[model samples]
Target: MLVSIDRRCIKLLQELEKETEFVSIKSLSESLDQTRRQTQYDIYKINSLFEFDKLPPIEAKQHKGVRLMDVHREWLKDLLDQENKKEDSEYNYVLTQEERCAVIICENVLRNGFSTLDDLSEQLMVSKNTIFIDMKIVREKLKEYNIECEFISGKGYLINGEELEKRKVFMYYISSIYGLISDGMLDYLQDEDVKRHIEVLHKIEEELEVHYNKGIIEKLALMLHFSETGENTKWNFPQKTGSALVCVNIDHVCRSHVYGIIDKYMKDRSDDEKAYICIHLLAGRMNKEYYLYNETEEIFEELAEKLVGYFETLVGVTMDKRGSLIEDLTQHLSRSSYRYIYGINDGSELETIIRREAEELFNVVRKVADRFSHDIQCPIDDQEVAYLAVHFSSHMHRTSAKKYRYSSMLICDESEKKRENLKKRIEDNIPLIQIHEVLTKAEYTEAEKNKYEVVISTEVLDINDGYVLISKKFDNTDHINILNEVLQSRADEVSSLSDDLFDQIKPYIQKKQVGTVRSIVDHFFGSDQNSTLTQLLTRERVKCLGDKDVSLSWRDAVFQAAYPLLADGSINRHYIDSIILNVELYGAYFYFDNGVYLTHAKDTSGVFRSGVSVMTIPRGINFPHNKKIYILFVLASVDEKEHFGVLKEILKVCDSKEKTEWLLEAQNEDVLYKNLRMIAEKK
Candidate 1:
């Protein structure tokens, strides 16, 4: 039997397998978005369980990080696979206060009993104040579903609501929290009727020509089981109450097939149960299959058009006409609506991958999808959003559109040196435009005014040609405005309106791909491929400070560590805050062993540029959960691939106890830099 473990431990185990090098507390904390202290506590809990179960202990690598010390990695993996094969209910989870409250309240209401705050507090092993807060949150949550949590003075508190709504809330909450099957709930499916019901479902699917997402059939079967079991309990459905639910329009043949199946196990209760199960069937269908119903065809068309429009706006290019991107999106939305309406789960696994690849488009799609969900009263999950992104991304790669390039000349009536400086400033600010020449006042000629695409002059010229007036200063808003005007006009040059949208999205989304404005524009326009990894890993971005004996608070240390990047304008305050936020939420996942903390925000929200900052402390700073860090390496990167080479170099330097110790004992910044260079060179 597998040892009982909480979700955190399970996550730790999963994360451990992915670690190429020794896993750090800071890395785990950031990835898990838990505090370092909480992460350490979880690690301790998991390690203790491992000890109790006589499993190989997770070995600490001194200053590096933690490692799965089992000699046979494959054997350890097989052991984990064995544990996963066990029933989900057999695994125990360390529930949060809210989850505990939900369980307690759900059981109490299902039993048609009242429980005082004091009773709940004692039972859940929390203070009465905590129970009070839990109840308040529960009450607020139930209100959204039109369920009421009534408090009777002498009777304590009991839930008063319609049976169907109560059961909906109950099943939704339970399934969502405990995963697909709960302990008692699993027994319902274990019975013989489950097989027959599945057969009926399969027949219905065959007739409808629609398939369901995996496990959805079981979920629907469980609903029927719940309806039958709840019949014996106080939960009762009113005949009129069924009308409030949007009825799924099953064809006559499919309806009869479903009714025939339900009649075998639930003869008298078939009417209500069949309707309830049909709602679930509708929710889980993976295809649009709108030809079966005329009314839905129009609805799906509208949804598809809206989704396509939103995607176009997001990716900034018209989709290729050859594909069924709209039809595909429509089908996904059709199925996704059920997930939203019924509160079914769509996971974030794919979203993470898509986010890393094309984050700007992901954010746009998410925002647009959210708006659509609001209109339709269905909440869009990131998983569904990611699926949409996949379709849009495919469209993006297969098609091409015309991009604008501006060519202009600067006519500055200033000295040679001043004109040169002004030209560089304009080039830095508006790199998309090619400045043909910088003409001084003495060199000015009316005949050469129209030679370039646009003319930018410091003094107002009385010419009808394309002339933009600007100040003699380096950074002038008038020049920027004139350039923006020119760029905006170039939008019409493209075949699709989305090309304009792409231009609009560039400033917002191109932070990661930027070397300079010209490079960014060229990269976007398909003239240049992406930058090389070596070019991205430049030494100008690397910063280091050494101290054999210095100490600071964890928060202060992180702020101080990030200060160099912040001061240099490589990262904004938001980036620093994001790093701190990750630590606070995820615990010390970034805190590698050996007194080094790898701190960074998971996303590029606050990054002005991709850069790395390093701070060394001999005495070390104290993080939560007894984590002492000697070195702090804060990274701010726009791209996911930013740290690959850096991490490789760092891992080599900190691979062994001897190497990490020697590095820590380095006398000066020059020595540290030399050792770091040597290690990086070896790689």
Candidate 2:
């Protein structure tokens, strides 16, 4: 594909603005000598480039007239500076011009084989600042040809690095920092050795201007080598790494997936970084092993210290002193396994296990470590640490947010044979969980304040408001049935709470409500069928499907279910899930956002099949708007099937397309797409 020159045109316009700050369309048109429309066309072109590339957008306050915002004034100045430099170069074609002067001098210095930056600056009659900026442009342009301008502290810049070797290094460097997140860099700390490391990085950075501009840490990773280049880019390796093997198993099942990271880390970066990051991601799913490497033990230990230090800061506690915190990682992992004892027979039936190993795999410096939360996770009864999502931080500040369950409460009845055995089972299954408490009804109160928002009860009990009743009995009903029931029950509680809360604040809402809403509600409540209609309206979307008019496949079911509710205006919070799922089943496309799907349903792929929506996709997986519609299916029980709209309702609540898409894709049928591994027992 050919690249449009919008960025260049924007650059030109910005420079024109700077030179003539009070310039009109007439002046701008005269500068380009084009039509007034063409001058405006340039501004539009500028916006498109900035919008697409995500460079700060050009903000114009006035709609009709040309204007420059306060924020853009600096950029305008820079633009004019560039234009002046260009004009100076064109008129004064000899290399004496300011912009060309430094490069010409550098070429002279390189031809002489050696000259310090001071000498070059003196020779060029410009400040070191101007010289450096000129060299900055030089280096940016040089890397395209696989050339690197080597630098020394006292010495000036020189592209004298061996051509072949430099090209390889440049490629490596580019791949490393392409999307490199800056973190883990030691600062000027209390320790001398740590300072040494930062100093080493600093000195190397000066010589590696291109790499600093890019990220050198990313280059160090070996896994993402071939991601940026086209598939035919002559660099190839064995298809899968050992870490890839490990991620394959639980990547889908894990609460937070690294697949997108893996994909992005694979394509837009270098092989080393890709592979290294993948290894880290795999270690993230420690104890729940699919692939194990020789260095798993060492790697797991390092990651632990990093996590501990991070949590200590987040939770306002000093967790552990950070040097190379590798020796006592086993102790740091709150507890190694979890056995969720279902209380139906007091949690014995759902005595399932979840394990988290690799507790102390991350190594951190104390100051850097002190900035994080060490209490990121811990396991409890019936609760398993499903995932450990890590985020990068710069120095000691949290550059990103991570979701780590600190402690999961596993509620069970106390009639088991032995407490020791149950405790052991829990420790073995849930590695990241600490022995917070083995709670029965009495113990449940003790463990009420936990990390999970809901207090998971083995059986339905009148506990606190936030207590959740998890089905301790894991009988093989249907996967969709399980999720649909759980989600709907939760939504119902939330809806009830919302209504009660609204009633409390009705006076305020009535005062604040715009005329349109007041008029509509008053009109409806005044009707004859107001009582019957109120019940239906309060329940949100009420379906009155008289009878099946035509034969329909599972593909068309969701849309069929939704069309009537939408028309009737009964499609409220409650009806969205059924509508989405019906559409997903019939149209073969799952419409969803994180547990919410209804609002995002309308943008359906008439030909929808496989898709994953994320706020940010690592591999850039986008919905194929023109692809054939896909039909989502599930082997659900009658109750779950009937209540299929429950999922759609959840999607609408989440209001996140990615979440809806993930759950929908996760809940898709194997008989239809042949990818039932997400939520199915394979025959």
Candidate 3:
């Protein structure tokens, strides 16, 4: 069984990932044809012996649904890939002509960490004597560049060329290898669906993976799979190797007819008259809206510009700053939305319930959105963040890799010197490098794709379908990574994946998930308390993504929201949670002032006090929606003179709009349920 689920299987999984709460014992057993007992044992070993992951809250219960830890479907893929890669391969078996060239490139890189030999030589082959004419042809190719090929004594052979020419040589080398691998991938994934997906994933790679920012790339890819098939896949190879994401205009997606259904009954419950595009999301209501943009880029850009315009309109009232305002808001949304999401205890039961038909999920989203919007008495779509995903996908990849720490030994002596000076000055100003690094080349390669930092190079760049150049600069010294910046860049060689809505986000957020929320927050918000909250918001937003067939469980939202609050920058303190979760068994019913004053505080303990920013955490994955619990807190009160005793009851209400209005009308102590002190002191 172990062998059956061996390296190849793992590698396959790495290539194809999905969104799933946890690695299933039954799935693994059936896929690998092992006993469930053995599967369980392997999971145990993975947890206890291998320590692959911390085994996130294996027994922790979701407030309402079945709870289970979500493992990146790609994990299975990567683990399998790693295992397969670990298997032995002869460094030099019967040499294929192409593999020989790659070997030569590696050898040169080992020697100088760079290379400049261009011609494909046959001298390393055992049948070199029979291929004398091919060798002559190779020699002729080298002569065009003033390079020379000669046989050496003990070492196979050496190609003599200046170090300055290394960029071209390396470009050709990677291109050759990429062509082979890309073709191989096409063949390996012969299944029609798999091939289509791979194609889409390739476009995502072109758009988002970027200059090896592994985390974002991985998450984006995993999420893409999750979006399409409702499966979570943990993949490592593409991320580790490099990938990209195509940007998507979420608003355009939301407004499209395919996004949601036209149910006349939904009208009474809905908040908007505008056309509604629900996509795979569950937007509860009967509404309509017009949408534009045939592709992700056009749509994302349109939405971003519109969203930005709306923000601009709100400038005097909402915010004052102009520069990087969108980025700042993006960070804000990323942090503020997590309070509503959580992990489940038994994922299977929850999956069974939430494992909806596409239409069902879509309807549920509409219902949830309509209901929630009604409860809040505000259009959720009005917030700056409501359209965040749409705009975020728009310009995220417009900038490319900055050229850093990379110097090409070249023939243009003075230009090269100028480039060097530019590098130094830029480095002095933006010294955060030694990471987010790129080896971009400014020189062109006949091989069609050039992959080197162009920031320091003076070489003339040509724009083709794949010839991406990171042209945007913050100054002479600051620039985006070229790999992701040039969205339509043609590369003789680059990570290729299919482009879809999920594919775009997948490439951007894939690997970034593990600790991404914190890192991105720290970068934007730093030690500020709001940073933690901001990441929660982004998590909140992410939780709401995907096909509505699987509604955003309040369970996940609740955990995402509060889990971040417990964080204090340091990993240690962040894990310690002091809060508790509770929901009414019969549902959170409204009680007028005339209702019973509870004899016991514990009975009312599960009830949130009014005026607090109430956050509802999800129960187990399969738990019913109403059973989800919340952390209620008092946010605002009517007259400042309201007593503390009355305040406690105000925070308990789960509904925000109602909570607000209730506080507004209160006139006497009767409106105030028992205060915190009374509840604590009571029997």
For model 1, the run of ten residues with the poorest summed lDDT:
238-247
**What is the Cα root-mean-square deviation between model 2 and the actual structure?**
28.5
- Compose the digit string of candidate 3's lDDT tens values, residues 1-683: 12122222333233224423334444545454434433443443333312334334232223221123335343454544553565532211234444454445433421322122222233343454534444444454444434566655444445665432222233333333432334342122334544454454444345433232212222222222212111122111111111111212335544554334422222322222111112212221112232121333333233333344433221101222333445433343232221111000111111111111111222222223333432222222211122232222222222122121322221122444554554543343222221222223533353423343222323445543322232223231113232222222222112222122234555567574835543444443221122121111222121111233235454343344333333322112212121212222312222122221111111222222212222322221222332322222212222222222232233222123333344333332233222222222221
Better of 1 and 2 by lDDT: 1
**Candidate 2, residues 1-683: lDDT per residue as tens digits?**
22234332644455555653455665566554344434555676566655654566654444234556554566555544654455432111122233343333223322324456677677555678767766766565444434466676766666643222232333322322222113211111324543443454444334434123223333323212222333333322112243311122233323334434444423543443333333333332334443333234454455566655443332222332334233333333322211110000111111111111111112112222322212221112111221221111111221112112224455667465544445444333323233455567665554364454434445556655445454444221221232233334344544555455556656766565745554554443321112211222222222222224234432233444344344444334334464345444333233321221122233222212211211111122222222222222111111221122233222222332322344344322222122222112110
TM-score of each: 0.41, 0.23, 0.20
Best-matching candidate per lDDT: 1
For candidate 2, the TM-score is 0.23
In model 2, the runs with Cα more than 4 Å from the true position are 1-127, 130-299, 318-497, 504-683
Tell me which of candidates 2 and 3 scores higher on TM-score: 2
Clashing pairs counted in every model? 25, 112, 147
Root-mean-square deviation of candidate 3: 28.7
